[model samples]
Target: MGLFSKDIKTMDDLFVHTLKDIYYAENQILKALPDMIEKATDGGLKQGLQAHLGETKNHVVRLEQVFKMHGAKAEGVACPAIDGIIEETNEIAGEIDDKKGLDAALIAAGQAVEHYEMTRYGTLIAWARQLGRADCANILEQNLKEEKAADAKLTALAERGINAKAA
Candidate 1:
């Protein structure tokens, strides 16, 4: 169903729909990371992307747990937002020939993905709590915390030397 589909008649439905959205997004990230890891020229950036790939797996599992806890079918909806971000990243990465510049671009791409995730997770947490699903909210908080940390790490890598190297 679409975001504004009549199928989502209640707040709970919206929560479940969002859960599915993130579930799909995480899986997509899981698929995209290996390529990013391969493309990254900087050791630190590569390692960070690799680490996040592992965390993304866990995030998917946690989302499944939340689904079970909430008695919703574990599934995903099409997330155009993530798809667009990944496509943009790939397009940008392909255009940059310099390794250092590519590294910098990768970091920016990673941050874009993280920011999208952070927004979704934050909204999901609030919705989960409103639906009286604190347990789900708490589990989602774990994902949010990791996303925030990942974004910070990307920022740190950019500031530390990647951007300078690119320049």
Candidate 2:
């Protein structure tokens, strides 16, 4: 038997896998956040991630809704992609000893996560629409907007706050 030979033979399987994918991603982010918070020295960046942590919790709730809307149990796969991102961030954080430098690293890491989420959200929104669940797409759009905003905020912080401080 082939590895992963169980057929994704139904829409339900696709929906559940997607839900699991995002759930794993979000959960990994939640776990990584405290370290980011601890590493950040920029007052604004630290505060920003803190705020996003709350928003991220809401994101989990939103994903749960997507799962429920499809009548599927919310769960997650290992999500090697996000796990690797988190690992990379941790490595960078460990390498940088300066608090402000760490802050910059944290911002960079947060942006990486935001970019990943943006990609997933974009895909999920399109899939939701294709599946004839405009309502699901609409709900997902909220999280997508938030991810984009988080990325934008991180950029602004890097330019206006952290990078300047680092320099």
Candidate 3:
């Protein structure tokens, strides 16, 4: 069913729909990271992206687990927000030629993605709790922690040199 479909008549339905949204988004990120990795010019940025790529893969697995726990199918619905973020990143990356600038842009893009994930996870955790699924909330919290850490790491890398070098 489409987003805002009348089929979603309850919080549980909303929760599951959001879960599917993130599941699709995570899988898209899995597909997009390699290109971002390729475009990155900084060693630290590349390494960070690679590491997060691995973490993202595990996140997909964790999401599937949550789906099973919630008695929902381990499937995904298209997430236009993530798609737009990734597309914007690609467009910006294509427009830039300077290596340092590209790296900085990449870091910014990565942080954008992390911020999106943090919001999603934060909501999911709250909904899970409200739905009396502490188990699901706890599991989603792990993903939220990872997303926050990745954002912080990107910020640290940018502050250390990437941003200045870009400037």
Candidate 4:
């Protein structure tokens, strides 16, 4: 069955569905990052992608814990937003030929993904708490924190490093 296949018949259902969406997003990111890392020629950019890949693995674990806490199965609903973002990243990466400029594009793309994840995780944390799953909220909060950190790191890379090189 699909996420919307069933009516959002309960608060728990809504919560689980959002969890599943982000779970799918996180998994998609894991698949996309290797190419991002390989295409990123800057040492710092490569390292940053590697670090976020580790964090994304942790995000999957946290989502699983949230499901366990809520007595739901840890499954993914397709997230078209993430799929589009990954596709756009691939298109942009394919177009950029200069090594330094490509690194800049990669950083910009990475930050966009990070910003999207932060929003989803933030909303999920609020929903988890509203559903009276504080334990699940805690897990969601952990992912949110990591997402925020990744955003900050990407912002920094864009600000003083990659963007300058792209110019």
Model 3 segments beyond 4 Å from truth? none
Candidate 2 Cα outliers beyond 4 Å, as residue runs: 1-6, 10-12
Each model's TM-score, in the order given?
Answer: 0.99, 0.92, 0.98, 0.94
Candidate 1 residue lDDT tens string, 49-164: 99999999999999999999999899989999999999999999999999999999999999999999999999999999998889999999999999999999999999999999
- How far in Å is the alpha carbon of 162 misplaced in model 3? 0.3
TM-score, predicted candidate 1 vs. hidden true structure: 0.99
Could you tell me which residue pairs clash in candidate 2?
Answer: none
**Winner on lDDT (1 vs 4):** 1
lDDT of 3 by residue, 13-64 (tens): 9999999999999999999999999998889999999999999999999999
Backbone clash tally (model 2)? 0
* Shift in Å, residue 73, candidate 2: 0.6
Each prediction's whole-model lDDT (CA): 0.96, 0.84, 0.96, 0.87
RMSD (CA, Å), each prediction: 0.6, 2.2, 0.8, 1.5
Per-residue lDDT of 9 in model 3:
97
Instruction: Give the Cα RMSD of candidate 2.
Output: 2.2
Candidate 4 stretches greater than 4 Å from native: 1-6
Residue range 49-94, candidate 2, lDDT tens digits: 9999999999999999988887878888777888989999999888
By TM-score, rank the candidates, best first.
1, 3, 4, 2
